[model samples]
Target: MASMKFACIVIMCFAVVGAPIAQAISCGQVGNNLKPCLRYIMSFWGSVPGLCCDGVKTVMAHVQNTADKRATCNCLKSMVAKIGFVPWRAKSIPRECGVVLPYEISTSINCDKLEL
Candidate 1:
C-alpha cells in the first residue's frame, strides 16, 4: 500500500510539472511573439531590432515539439503570404537574431511535413 501511494504521488508530481510543457502553441501566440519583427521584415536594409531578436528567441524556446514547430511554421508561412515581406529578409531573420531554426522560413515550406 505504501509503494502504491508513492507511485501515485510521483505520477501526480509529473502531471503537475509537465502541464505547462504540454500547453498547445496557438497561431495567435506565434503572431503576437513575432509582431516585433514586422519593422525589420518590412525594411529593405537595417539592423535587426533587439525586441525582435528577443521575440524570436522566445518563440524558439517555447517550441518544444514537432507539433509546436509545425504550427509555428504554418503560422509564419501564412503571415508571410498575407503581409508580403521580402523573401530574403524573412529568410535571414533567424540567423540575424542568432536563433537557429530547424527549417527555413519561407512561404513554400511544407509545414505539415516537418519532423522533430
Candidate 2:
C-alpha cells in the first residue's frame, strides 16, 4: 500500500511537469498558421502552390480541449516555418507512438532542437 501511494505521487508529479512542457512546445507557433507539406515542398524548390496547410489542419481538426487544441495547432504551424513543410504525416502525436519517416531530415527541419 505504501509503495502504491508513492507510485501514484510520482505519476502525478510527472503529469504536472509534462503539462507545461507540452504548452511550451505549442507556444512557439501560436497563430503563425500551418503550411501544407505539399505546397511547402513545392515552395522550397519554387512555386505558387495553393494552401497546403490544410493537410495538417485536417489531421488535427478533431483535437479537443480548447487550450490543448490551440497548442497543438501551434505545434503544426511551427512545423511549417521550421521546415517549410510538415513531415509528420500525422498531425497530433501521442506520447507513446514513434514518428516514422523514410528520410533522414535532421538538417532539413529542426536543425536547432530546443532543449527538452
Candidate 3:
C-alpha cells in the first residue's frame, strides 16, 4: 500500500512539473536548427551560407501559427541574449537567407504583442 501511494505521488509530481516542458519551446532545439547559420549571423562581412538558408527554412516551417511563432521568437531571443548578438544581425538572418517570417527577429520583439 505504501509503495502504491508513493507511486501515485511521484506520478502527480511529474505530471505537474512536466506539463510546462511539453508546452514550452526549448532553446536547445532552436540552437540545433540554427547552428549552421551561427557563423554568418555572427560575422558582419560574409555571405549567408547555403546550409544556413536551409536551416532557416526548416525552423520557419515549424512555426505554423501565432503561438508557435511567438514561442520560436522567444526561443531565438533567448539564444541571442546568451550569445550577445547584434539585434540587426539577428533580424536580418531570415531576410538574408531569403526566408520570410511572420515576426521579425529583433531584440525588441514582444512575443505576445502580435497575432498571426
Best by lDDT: 1
Candidates 1 and 2 compared by lDDT, better number: 1
Off by over 4 Å in 1: 1-21
Estimate, for each residue in 1-116, the C-alpha lDDT of model 2 and write its tens digit. Answer: 99999999999998888754332323434333333344534333443233434433443443435555444544544544565443433232221123222223232344233221
Q: What is the C-alpha lDDT of each candidate?
A: 0.85, 0.41, 0.76
Report how far off residue 31 is in candidate 1 (Å).
Answer: 0.9
**Cα lDDT for residue 111, model 2?**
24
Stretches of candidate 3 exceeding 4 Å from the true structure: 1-26
Summarize candidate 3's per-residue lDDT along 23-92 as a digit string, tens digits: 4445577778789877776777677778878878877777767887788888877777667565667778
Worst 10 residues of 3 by lDDT: 19-28
Cα-based TM-score, every candidate: 0.80, 0.26, 0.70
Cα RMSD for candidate 2? 13.5
What RMSD, rounded to one decimal, does every model reach?
A: 4.2, 13.5, 6.7
